[model samples]
Target: MKKPFIFIISVLGVILESCYYDNEVYLYGNGSGAVCDTATVTYSATIAPIMASNCNSCHTASSGNGVITSDYNNLKTIVNNGKLLKSVNWTAGAIQMPLGGQKLPTCTLAKINKWVDNGALNN
Candidate 1:
């Protein structure tokens, strides 16, 4: 009984701890630790860095998931269609992007939301 209980707790612990991630992609890391001020998610300024540092590695113009987020048009298509985030989480957290432990920072997601709210502009 103790073994089962310990195993269950361990699993739950892992699951809980894996709910979020700290470091991955930042829109404009000034090294100033001021990401909160500009998570507006833009193609030229914000989204570029995030997609480049994180998504481009697996989903670029030439390879990976067939994602061409390098340009504003393709990115706009993905974001507007709501497939950008959804595609990354289709595997039930097993493959939640950044290809690692948790997932995107809450702040980063917030920026994306902001961008979405602002009409998913390329600015």
Candidate 2:
């Protein structure tokens, strides 16, 4: 009887623990219950790194994807035309970015929007 009770309790505890919800912004503290700073979103400082990590892999100049993100000029073309925001934001009729990967974090998306709203500067 003791063994059976202990086993049941352990299984219940495991099930409850597994049901608990957690995510990066919640645990690491950024998008939720923490600051998502978009105050100084610059090309070199902020936007460039984002593109390099998320976009440049497949959109490189040599990749012939017709969207070269490795350089500022090429990137600017899509930025100006609104493709960047649409794709990343996963807005209707726009192709989702990272092409089958998960959408960017909320904080990251906010930073991109901030950069774009600030004239998508080359700085």
lDDT of 1 by residue, 20-104 (tens): 6553335434344755644335667887887787677766777756557667788888777777666554445434666564566
User: Which stretches in model 1 have alpha-carbon errors above 4 Å?
Assistant: 1-35, 38-41, 88-95, 99-101
Give lDDT: candidate 1, residue 78: 76
Checking candidate 1 for backbone clashes, the offending pairs are none
TM-score of every prediction relative to native: 0.57, 0.73
Per-residue C-alpha lDDT of model 2 across residues 1-123, encoded as one tens digit per residue: 699999999999999999875643344334566766777789999998998999888999788379887788998899989999999999999999989899998889888887888898999
User: How far in Å is the alpha carbon of 49 misplaced in model 1?
Assistant: 1.1
The candidate that wins on TM-score is 2
**Candidate number with greatest lDDT:** 2
Deviating ranges (above 4 Å) for candidate 2 = 1-29
Candidate 1, residue 73: lDDT: 85
